[model samples]
Target: MRLVVCLKAVPASTEVAMDPVTHTIVRDGGDAVWNPYDTAALEVALRLKDEARAAGQEGWVGVVSMGIPATASLLEDALSRGADEALLLSDRAFAGSDTIATCYALTLGIGRLCAEPDLILCGKMAVDGDTAQIGPMLAAALRLPVVTGATTVERHGAAVDVEQVFDGARRRLCMHGPGVVTVDKDAATLRMPSIEGVLAARRTSVPVATAADLGADLDRCGLAGSPTQVVSCFVPERASDAVAIEGTPAEQAATLAYLMGEVLA
Candidate 1:
């Protein structure tokens, strides 16, 4: 059996700033880290591999990440954490990709790496985009069954079961064959890398595949294929003012309420 996990590199800081002129993420000169949700997805794949081994079947875990050339470091991190293989999808033409384009490129790359994976995992959402759209999109494009927001997963024989969380309920999903699932925030965290693993990961030669290598259509793998367009992106100006409340405590409370009502109205 083979398992594949999808990953994204996101800004380390939560307060990621946008470029005032370009209206795009200020990705330059910022520390980039693997998406937290993707880490959970990796952990899920590792655990599934362990279970499969115990069941007398061996499984390999691989990861696929798409971004600039710098993102190869992101895949190395996954290798350090114990993925058996990693693939990087980097190309200039892949810039400014929306979720649709992203899913297309990812599915193309993953399909090349693992023609028939027993399972596929992804984070419930990317920290930067927070759209949570790629997992299902990839599944649909590949014509495979999918379930999202999985907090727990179990595999028995050829069937995979997951505890899927929705708005106000948790549904148990069972798939009889190869399928995809997105790990929720509540999934297990990954273990830290060992000294030897860290050094080995740095030496891991991750192969990069471009749009041509993945056989991705030029029009469907980048900004040109993206339907969503950004009109503008700028931080909202903060407005702040202080008002003095001159009176007894009761009167101050009443004045505060009145001011709040005015602001709300």
Candidate 2:
């Protein structure tokens, strides 16, 4: 069985600045890390792979990412965790991709990985955009069943059982293999890489594929394919005088209750 995990590299800092003209986060010259949600997805994928191995089955885990060539380092982290191989989709033509365009590029890359994949895992959302649209969009483009916001997953034969969280409620879902899953942060904690894992990752080669390599249609691969355009960006006006209410314990409790009621109401 082959499992593919899609990951995105996002800005590491919480205080991200927006481009005045583009209405998008200014990403250039910033520290980057794997999206936190994607880390959970990776952990789940690794656990699944380990289970398969322990059961005497041959399982392969692949880390697949779409970004600039420099972002290939992001795959190294996944490799150090447990993935068998890494595929990087990078090209100048893939620049300025919106969610739709991203899904298109990702579909093309995934197509090149293998004819069929037993499972595909992705983060519930990418921190840079926070739209949480690419995973479902990719599933739509590929015409595959998708389970989003999955917090837990288990495989039984060729089928998968997933526990999905939605609006504070958990729903159990069952689907056959060759499906897509977008995992939430509550799914699992990420595993730290051991020294041996790090050295192994450093020695492993990451194959890079471009638009030409993927044979992607030029009219539907990047900025040219994006239908949405940003108009402008500006910082929101901040409150001039932020007030703090402090008093005796009783007074503080009363104030907190009043605020909560007002907010809820």
TM-score of each: 0.87, 0.87
Give the Å shift of residue 252 in candidate 1: 11
- What lDDT would candidate 1 get against the real structure? 0.86
On residues 195-252, what C-alpha lDDT tens digit does candidate 2 reach at each position?
A: 8889999998789999999888988877788888666655589879654779999998
Candidate 1 stretches greater than 4 Å from native: 15-22, 236-264
Clashing pairs in 1: none
lDDT of each: 0.86, 0.85
Pairs that collide, model 2:
none
